[model samples]
Each structure stands twice: as structure tokens, then as C-alpha cells.
Target: MFRNREEAAEQIAARLEHHRGSNPLVLAIPRGGVPMGQVIADRLEGELDIVLVHKIGAPGNPEFAIGSVDETGHVELNPGVERYGISPDYIDSEAERQLENIRKRRQRYRRPPTRAEGRVAILVDDGIATGATLFAAIRSLRAQNPSRLVVGVGVAPPDTVERIRREVDELVCLEAPAEFMAVGQFFQDFRQVEDEEVIAALGGESS
Candidate 1:
């Protein structure tokens, strides 16, 4: 178990030591991954940036992701999302709502645009649950033609780890427990990450 995100990031950065001097682009999922992204970026001597993607939740359970939409409005529905009986209209509206949140986060973060093409891109997140957002993130980053696409996370379920492993060039995950409940369960300090923390991690002077 990780003491905190900082400890987990340090371990992940050590595993990615090969890219230490490659000046890779470290793209983190906001609200949670930013803190770890800052640590990894500093350790690897890479630039830090954010990739915006939001999960489209089920009608009743907002925590249950049926699909995800990226910043560019590209939507990816899970293979068995139809099992949830979610209608096309519902999916469309949810995608739009989540996309709007992404837009607002983009404006708030104010991170300078950085391209992943022809660069080594590493996507980081605190952890993975359904892998919905990470799936969309990988697809979005893949479209950019990054020379190498890597994914690093703190913990994930065994099934989700294998699924994500197939999507990226390399995946550096610290733990893949078979009996998983949630990401926070694996960390001692799993407090909610506020927007101010994200802004500060991205080198912005948060007010």
C-alpha cells in the first residue's frame, strides 16, 4: 500500500528511469493525477501537461461509468454499455455535459498547450477503476502520434491492468490486486484533490 500519492509517484518514476533523460511529455489526468504528474515530471526531467477526459456515468449511479468523452468531443462507450440500457440520447447528453466540465477545467488549469507528436508521452493517473477515462485518454493521445505511449498508475484491478496494457506501448503499474474495491483503498492518504492543488502542480500561482 502506498503511504500517499507522492510515495507512489516516486516508485513509478523509479520504474520509468529509462526515460529519465528523454524529455518525455508527462500527461496526467486532472483532479487526481496532477500531484503525481508533478513528481514524475520533475524526477524524469520532463514537461508536465494535462489530458482532459470525463466519464459518462449511468443514469442512477454517477460513479458507474458507461462511457467517456475526451476534450475533442470524441466519445468511447464501453463494449457492454448496452447492458446498462442506456439510450443513445442519454449517452449523447451525458457526453456533452462531461465535455463541458472538461472545457471548464481546461480554462481553469490554464496549462500551456503541449504536443505529444514525436515525443515520448507518459499518461499518469492516481489509479484506475473501470479504466473508462484512461481508455479515452489513450485513444486521444494515440491520435497525436506520440513516438512512445506509456501509462503509469498507482493501482488497478487485474483485468483492467491487462486491458490497459494492450492499449499502450508500455504500462508501469505498481499494483494489480485481484480483490479491489476502490483506488483510495490502496492509499493511506486519499483525500480529494482540489483545483488549487492542480493549478499549483502545473506551475501556476494559485490564488
Candidate 2:
């Protein structure tokens, strides 16, 4: 188990030692991944930035992600999202709602996103559960035509790991236990990351 996000970041940075000095771009899924992204970016001598993507929660159960929408309004639905019996209209509404949130975050964070074109880009997150949001992030980054894309997370279930592996060129996952329940269960200090922390990680003053 990780002592905290810092320890986990150090381990992940070690695993990615080969990327040191490569000037890779580290794009973090905000609110949780920002701290780790800062560490990794410093360790690898790369730039740190945020990738905005919000989960499209299932109807009546906001914690359950039906899919996700990225900053560019690109919606990626899960393979079995139709099983939820959600209408197309509902999906459209949810996507727009998420896009608004992404916009607000972009403004609040106040950090200009770095382009990934022709560069090695790495996406970092605290952990992964269903991976709906991360998948959307991957697709969004792919559109930028990064020369190489990598994903680094503290922990994820084996199933999610395999699915993510298929999406990225390299995936650095610390733990992939077969009996995973939640990402927090693997961390001793899985506290909620505050917006101020994210802003500071990006060297922006909180508004």
C-alpha cells in the first residue's frame, strides 16, 4: 500500500526512469493526479499540464460512470452503456454538462495546456476503477498526435490494466490485484484532492 501520493509518485517515476531527460509531457487527470504529475514532470525534466475529462455518471447514481466527455466535447460511451436504457438525449445533455465543468476547471486552473504533437506524452492519475474517464482522456490525447503516449497510475484492477494497455503505447501500473474493490483501498492516505492543490501544482494562484 502507498503511504501517500508522494511515495506512489516516486515509485512510478523510478519505473519511468528511462524517460528521464526525454522532455516528455506529463498530463495529469486533475484533482487527484496533479501532485503526482508535478513530481513526475520534475523528475523527468518535462512539462506538467492537465487533461480535462469528466465522467458521465449513470442516471440516479452519479458515482457510477456510464462514460466520459473530454474538453473538446468528445463523448466516449462505455461498451455496455446502452444497457442502462439511457436515451440519446440524456447522453447529449450529460456531455454538455460535463463540458461546462471542464471549461470552468480550465479557467480556474489558469494553466495553458501544452500541445502533445510529436512529443512523448504521459497521462498520470492516482488510480483507476472503471477507467471510463481515462479512456476518454486517451482518445483526446490521441487526437493531438503525440509521438508516444503512456499511462501511469498507482493501481488498477487486472481487467482495467489490460484494457488500458490496449489503448496506450506503454502503461506503468504499480499494482494490479485480481481482487480489487476501490482505488482508495490500496492507499493509506487516499484523501480527496482539493482544487487549491491542483492550482498550486500547476503554479497558478487559486481564485
After TM-score superposition, the amount by which residue 194's alpha carbon in candidate 1 deviates from its true location, in angstroms, is 1.0
Q: What CA root-mean-square deviation does each model show from the true structure?
A: 1.0, 0.9
Pairs with backbone N, CA or C atoms under 3 Å apart (clashes), candidate 1: none
- Least accurate stretch of 10 residues (summed lDDT) in model 2? 198-207
Q: Estimate TM-scores for all models.
A: 0.97, 0.97
lDDT digits (tens) for residues 1-207 of candidate 2: 999888899999999989988899999998789889999999999989999999998888888899999988999998888877999998999899989999988988888778999999999999999999999999999999999999999999999999999999999999999999988898999888999989888888876
How do the residues 119-155 of candidate 1 rate in per-residue lDDT, one tens digit apiece?
9999999999999999999999999999999999999
Model 2 clash pairs are none
Runs with alpha carbons beyond 4 Å of true place in candidate 1: none
Query: Candidate 2, which segments miss by more than 4 Å at Cα?
Result: none
